[model samples]
Target: MKNFNWTNIRLFLIVGVAVFLYSFSGIRNEGRKIKQAEVVFVDNENFITKKDVNKLLKQNFDTVTGIKKVQLDLNKVEKSIDTNPMVDKAEVYATIDGKLTAIVVQKKPVARIFSGSKSYYLDYKGNEMPLSESETARVPLVSGSIDRTDKKRLSELLNYIYDDDFLKKNITGLAVMPWGDIMMDIRGYDFEVVFGKPINIDRKFKNYKAFLQDAIKDTLTENYKTINLKFTQQVVGTKK
Candidate 1:
């Protein structure tokens, strides 16, 4: 009897079994109908819901319910879901055990815009998001002849405000002047902060903060009518 190479033989057997099982599973699942479909959002604070996903799926893949797993085109299904303006990313896949899964991520809105002609949210990526009646996002409100052209600098300002806890809580309104100066309205104070353009934006904010720090000690914030940040390295306050 020839001495057997047990290692080689064992490897071959393992590979052969794996191949056989894969082929068998594929064959067995081919005619089996898709049992379930699950849709999940990547984040807890989401604009889109499972019901919306279901509606989209039904609209795009009407025959998916009774179709065999092998017949489903996951790529096409994903593309359909991704068409929604609210969706930032979408992934669709099917498992051999007769279940299809979809994972979706919704766009994040940083600011809301009330332009003359229309109203929408400017997402972090500067894309337009239709204002939601179901839920309202707590973000800075921008008004005054704004359009998509202002999205970049607008996004930057919103980001700065949101990043700072004090600014996020106190600043409620933002307005753009005709000559391109940006104005912000504080929640409690009646005055508006004139933030001219975005030049030296960080320094302007620093100066504003310094002024506030000093004003709080003497209660001067209430008397100031306007805090102009257009001048170099200063926050010029006008009396009421």
Candidate 2:
């Protein structure tokens, strides 16, 4: 007869009990009520507030407290939060302590476009964002009858303008003429600049910088009504 190994049987029984307890604990926790919710914004930009997030959560996942974990549609709640125009991203999750958490990211606007049908903002990702009455983003303003086809180039131009501190501060408005020409309105100047198309941006800006440096030295910036950048070799000036 083979000797019975009591140690092996004891070890197996202990492991089985541990696993059973762990599974029971998980089942109990799953049925536990959700205690509270926490809404956290990624940054303090205030483009979307905690109050706004709570309001949205209330709309989709109302009073989740006292409700079981398996009952809440977390994916649907996240999708609902993401549907807001101002929100760029939303992450929803439930903690082991029965607390729900949502992290939201707001869209950052690059420029404000004044279209004929509506006024909207162009975000950093080149998407249209609706203007908020509570907050005003001081970005470059693109004013004119800008068609949908022209928005991409115009957004690129605005992003370039935004990248330069001098341009962002001095160039206030961009007007797209009916003939497809782009004119930039300079701040504190009576005249406008004809920036032409969106080609050879580096060369054009370099020429423009040199011309501006010389013009400022000669105190002739106010003398010209338009500074043309259409030509490759020369910065043309049409005097008032």
Candidate 3:
């Protein structure tokens, strides 16, 4: 137009650049806030509760003295959890927004055995786990001469216990004889099941079931002292 004001123009351009930079910085911060991650979900089942998982994580990770950051290595944590005897498997994942998730499966106890100083928990697969004090009362106790129970025989006995519903419920204790015979103390009826040898327990259980179905109708006014299922396919009982 009239005279070009170079100084004013330069000043205005500088102001504009500063304003744009400030606005861009604000936008960048807003984007970061929008993209922030959150803990979205947790799945707990089969004796592996969310609380239990959290507790374990805290015990292993959070309690570490030098861990300045809360960066979670999911694979490492999952591997650590799998080492537990009760944990069958464990998985950990992170969501798109950065939420962490954990899933776990726990071992089921088939029978709890008490050997002298310590207790052993036997799973359905016959894997032995250390007995926890908190779980002592819930599972049935296996007492008497547990030292005589070798791995093979224990596995066989566990298989028998898992298959027979009556034995699972009624049998309270197990005593292993020197000759590999098993004596069981049952509940409800006042009798012990003299189950000889872990071999052919299925047949013996079937025989016992058949006999009780007929005999317990009115014959057991009191209780049976012992029901021997040792010889052949017969169920021999002694009255209390």
Candidate topping TM-score: 1
Candidate 1 lDDT, tens digit per residue, 34-77?
87889988986557778888787777567457778777777888
Ranking by lDDT: 2, 1, 3
Model 3: per-residue lDDT, tens digit, 1-240? 699899999999999999999998655543331122122223232344455556655555534223322355667877876776767777766543334455676776767887677777887677887665344424567766766657677677776776667677777777877666788877877778898877776788888888888876867725678889997557898877
By TM-score: ranked, best first: 1, 2, 3
Best by lDDT: 2
Of the candidates numbered 1 and 2, which has the greater lDDT value? 2
In the range 1-240, model 2's lDDT, one tens digit per residue, is 999899999999999999999999989878888899899888766777777878877784556677898888899989989998999989999888999899999888888888786889998778989987668888878876576236667767777877889888888887777767778888888877898876666777788889989999999988999999988799999998
* Candidate 3 lDDT score at position 194: 90
Q: What number of clashing residue pairs does each candidate have, in the order they appear? A: 0, 0, 0
RMSD for each of the candidates: 2.6, 3.2, 11.2
Which lDDT values do the candidates have, in the order given?
Answer: 0.83, 0.83, 0.67
lDDT of 2: 0.83
